[model samples]
Target: MPMGCPFLSLRFSLFLSLSFATSSSPFSFFKLQSPSSSIPKATSSDLLSLLASPSHSSSVNPSVADELKSCFKFLVPFTPINTRSSSDFKSPSSRRSLLKSLRDEQNELIWWPPEPVLELARLAFDSGGDPDSIHRALDPTVMPVPDVEGSKEDKCELTRTPYGRRFISQELNSYLEYLFKLIVERGPDVGLKVSLNRYDLFHGHLFIATETGRLGILFHAKEYPLYDKQVFPYYLGYCQKDSNVTYDDSINLRNILWLAPLPSNSTQGWIAPGVLLVLDAHPGGIVYRDLIPEYVNVVRTIYEDDLGNVVVDVNYLNVGDSQPDYQIFIC
Candidate 1:
């Protein structure tokens, strides 16, 4: 495992104050409460139980229950039934039957929140252990929309329109932008002050998958202050690949998310994990046939940077057919 850099040590924290208003949408049932308020925070076990079996809890709001059911239905295939000690599965056949039933229950037309956003909701649940936070994280209205046209200089100059743009909806785009901002905002504190570039070129699709098993948008270089000349050189070096692969031929900006080293448990060396969240839902997948090598090459370069490189593991999680794909690259 890679360790944290002493020069880039910083703690990332997300502070959310949730307040809800009544709306017809299923997600509107989540009411926001301040962290400082008297309401007790839900434990991890409590949240897992609610997500695993929302029907059993009478206190769960009807609308929220409906949403949880949708999420549960979507997550069933990817969740490992055997590892769940709390589940009362009698045999392998019963587990398979249940999974099949869950898959059959899925409605093709119903709109569920994007997989990356849902994964972020899961992460929020794990960190804060609050059900409301999960809903708040999935709420599109609360997410910040990226100002693509406003910040041109800060963006990387792309040779062409991103391949994944067509598949991403406006709502999903906002959610991806929100995630980029959150990561940058919560990134390690180095000597420099990190900020969002707010450029569309900084955002694209990497042909990657999210936790829900669907492709997602890539938010590259969200933390690096692109305007700074000293920092810009490193950004260019990071993107530099083989001479045969031109800027147009390579996955230049697609893989670079945050440049700063994040806090990690390992004490060996600096560990900067690059996360790829695929939100695109096109059945045919987005990567151009010729550019597939570019994507693989970038991942290869990150892992095998030095001659005596340490072994780094990349974890992937997939769920439903339409769910987004999620991958974590520790470099």
Candidate 2:
């Protein structure tokens, strides 16, 4: 391996070699081993239980820490798009290349006629009656399906973004929930492993728990701007509570554009929104913002009825293309 040769000169070779440890996917709800076990439909209590468990509070995993460091590197503006020596893996070129590709592929959705849920809710409020009557006046072809299925229906309907498949649901919580499944139950079972890698703006730093009540992994160094793009940065921290991912100290991602908050496109039948954005801070800790004069974007929230019906809850017409500051809570 020469100094800059495929292995010696570039770090990508070393990264490929780091998988010495391997892990990690999919199943139906009814077939699982839970209270319902049939559809994998987790109730509030189940979620609460997981959140209450201490296993989630483990010390940060070194790989995840490195990956996160890489993400912060991306927040820096036009840092040299060099290779990364991520964790045991060497070379950062792959991450830099991967991020450039991802950025190129991102696409924003269009603002449109207000979605049905919000429209219906408003109509009912104005008419002093349920908007159910609107059903008779419209065509059914455009109606939302009670249940959307895909290759991995049990996992979740995929999340979409201007940058391609970025999240599961439109709500922040929904996307986090999907991630929770992967990290907690799924990531550990097989050879799946997560690091704070190139998937910037998607997660904050977290430790993978090795046991019920002990620290398993640790990684991080207040190392900011961990990527070639260097557009966003976040301070990774361990959770104090079990299974709970709450950050006692508020993390502001507005310092860098890469970490800006994403719009929640729930009405599009997406389960969550904005779970992918990570943010950074300026030199003096001031959020450097741009007065973007663009407009005519929209966001919609959706609600479903128990009998298996879909409805819009609220919708907003965002006046510009810029994103807001938000904390990413990847379970």
Candidate 3:
């Protein structure tokens, strides 16, 4: 647990109204909201009960449930551009070279006015209740595909279409609920002390530090960055087609991202506004969980809705499983 953890004070009836700071480094804690504030509060007990259960239950009060749902509104559904096994290249070198070429091409499309950029521009408008402005900000042009040698048209096809074709609505909701429950289970004191890894942040992967000197949860660190490009590539396109994929187990992509509090360090650079939390799974390679064994006693939560929809939620990476596929909670 963190030193003098504020979560302990939460039990004393504290109400936190969290808002990201609008600065180059936006990691500071904001002012607390009074009990009578319009923002709903998630009591310490309410959080603990959600955490204690393996799945989602309506046992908690409606206010806490509403707040939990609101946290996920800004999350953008996503998929990876390429995986190691998605091609028929016999050698690792061949696959690596091709993946790099594709990533470089996709990087050029992240500018404002594209599909994702256009969608992102609407978040503020939607929240502010200005529906008329959402479409006005979009650039409807179909982006031009990159023309590179070797794959040429194929590379262009991969670059322009890199996100997931279909959003996993049920799974995404379950993942967020499970994440919130984990924090509550850790208690307020423990949550305050969690740290973010600088190395992971630089590569856009998220690493959470739970205990005093150990690593917590690691999301989207499965694939090593391209040997030439030190920074891990972010996919602006969609998943590869199964017909073009020749690698074994290439289709087993479980995309999920953790949207949580990040610790700010002087060297980590600017924090982008309205960031989305999308978790990417490990490439077709051996999976490694936590480096430290002490942090590997995994606990999965199952949330059941009134409609009898069951969600057995597990974190992205399987930290302790010898065969990660079998241990994965989601099918």
Best candidate (score: TM-score): 1
> Residues 1-331, candidate 2, lDDT per residue (tens digit)?
0011212321232233222212211111111122322223322122111222122212334333332333332211221111121131122122222334432323110111113322332333333333343333233333221221121223221112111121122442333233322232222222223222111112222211111111111111111222211221121111111111221111222211111111112121211111122222221111111111011000000001211122221111111224422222211
Candidate lDDT scores, in order, read 0.25, 0.21, 0.23
Distance from true location, Cα of 65 in model 1, Å: 38
lDDT of 1 at 103: 27
Backbone clashes counted, model 1: 17
Best by lDDT: 1
Q: On residues 121-223, what C-alpha lDDT tens digit does candidate 3 reach at each position?
A: 3332233423223233333433232221212332222221321111133343243334433332322221121111111110112222221111112222111
Cα-based TM-score, every candidate:
0.25, 0.17, 0.20
Each prediction's RMSD over C-alphas, in Å, is 21.0, 24.1, 23.8
Better of 2 and 3 by TM-score: 3
Each prediction's number of clashing residue pairs:
17, 65, 15
